[model samples]
Target: MTQNQINQSAWAEKWPAPAKLNLMLRITGQRSDGYHLLQTVFQFIELCDWITFHPVDDGRVSLQKPIPGVPEADDLIIRAAKLLKAETGCEQGVRIEVEKNLPMGGGLGGGSSDAATTLVVLNALWGLQLSMEKLMELGLTLGADVPVFVYGYSSWAEGVGEKLERIDIPEQWFVVIKPNCHVDTKEVFLSKDLTRNSKSIRIADFIAGQHQNDCLGVVRERYQSVKDALVDLSEFSEARLTGTGACVFAQFDSEEAAVSAYRSLQKKWQVYLVKGVNESPLFSKLKSGNIS
Candidate 1:
């Protein structure tokens, strides 16, 4: 069958859009083009926002349920679908339904993961059969973090967070807390007090516990809720902010320890106990032919 005449029901299935945590974020320098040079480690967490696509023969991309306060045009999922359609001259379209469990602006890469899932799922649904490199390139147009989700593995990243090399790390449990606030990443980056220069360290140094987030100081000073979350969580373990701000996390040796910490904080904050994985859940489903 031609693309426009394909059956919609056959392609309908749920796909995972897994959240990520930045194990370490270091600002190595600033680029002349106004982008920050970053050295960071990205690992997937089992926490995810599930997305399902229903093919539409009308050739117009849309969201089945629009997110509050966000216009459909501005939704990254819609943008991703449109970008894929336009780039490949595909006649197929889809209505996306997002079960948004990930918090917005929480430094958990929720939106980027949603966008990456859109690109990956649509590429397959539309039968475009695009190469992995091509999908990663398309994902980069959505956001810096989107490509990592597209790559579908834990990775060490550099160069505005695009250059990636796959790395395997311990599968530890984490207690993630989202404070009652939003952190604007742009504001954090623009802060004059933000650390812009730090000596680059090897992965060995990271394993040796020689890394810290350069944005932590500015985030702590500017966002009191984040500061409070950090201080409170630290009482249980060494809590550190992920990505820019608004969410802080601490690692534990076992699920019981992480759950204990999470239980203590649950009444006061929005918390999650997630297991870190080297491979994304999205890829796991794909490899197993759970979605096609």
Candidate 2:
């Protein structure tokens, strides 16, 4: 049977598109081509959007709400599928089902994770047989953080977020709060006051000392909701913005502590207690053919 034939025989199950937290981001420099050079640690959290793909005859992709306020053509999931099919010469098309749980533009890397999940699962379903590196290369066209999800491991990221080194992060629970406001990453980067000249530090250095997201200042200024969320969550722990804005997170030593914090804020905010994972279980299940 051909690739499409195989996919048509079974109903594709939902795959995980896990959200990520940039524990710390430092802008080292800007590339001549306009990409930012940065260093950061990316941690995979239990918070995710689930996606399932079904084989389709026509070359098309689709989405389900709550939409991220972007056009369908600009949706990263479709862009990712089209890119993979073009690169690998796979004629198969897929109808995507996205159950979006993560907030849009919350700096949680939600959309990028969705795109990367498409690339990884479709590579297998379409029988592309591409290595993770090759898939990651394809993912880069979708976005910077896409590669890390394709890498399927908690990683240290740098250099426009493409360069990745797998790292063992401590297992912990996180209280993530989305203030329901969107902060555009481009605006934050272009702002004059945004820090773009922090000294580059080694991963070990970050592990040992204070590290911060350089985009925090610009994002906070533009979004008062995020600022409020940060201040509110700070009572539990030192609240920090993950990527650019709109979501703030605090780490807890135990699941109970995280859940307790989440429960307290449940009445007012969208709060979640998510555990950090080194490996994505969705990918593992797919690799082992558990979902086929």
In order of appearance, the predictions have TM-scores of: 0.96, 0.92
Query: How does model 1 score by TM-score?
Result: 0.96
Residue-wise lDDT of candidate 2 within 1-292, one digit each (tens)? 6546555543457778988898998998888887789999998888888888887787655654435567888888888888887886778777888888888878888889999888888877777888988988888878888899889888888899999998998979999998988888888888889887899988788778557989888888788888888888988888998988678999999888888889988888988889988887566656664433
Name the weakest run of 10 consecutive residues (lDDT summed) in model 1: 1-10
Which lDDT values do the candidates have, in the order given? Answer: 0.90, 0.83
lDDT score of model 1? 0.90
Summarize candidate 1's per-residue lDDT along 1-292 as a digit string, tens digits: 5544442443666789999999899998999988999999999999999998886778888888999899999999999999998889999878888899999999999999999998988887788889889999999988999999999999989999999999888999999999989999999999999899988878888878865999999999999999999999999889998999689999999889898999999999999999999999999988764445
* lDDT over C-alpha atoms for residue 58 of model 2: 76
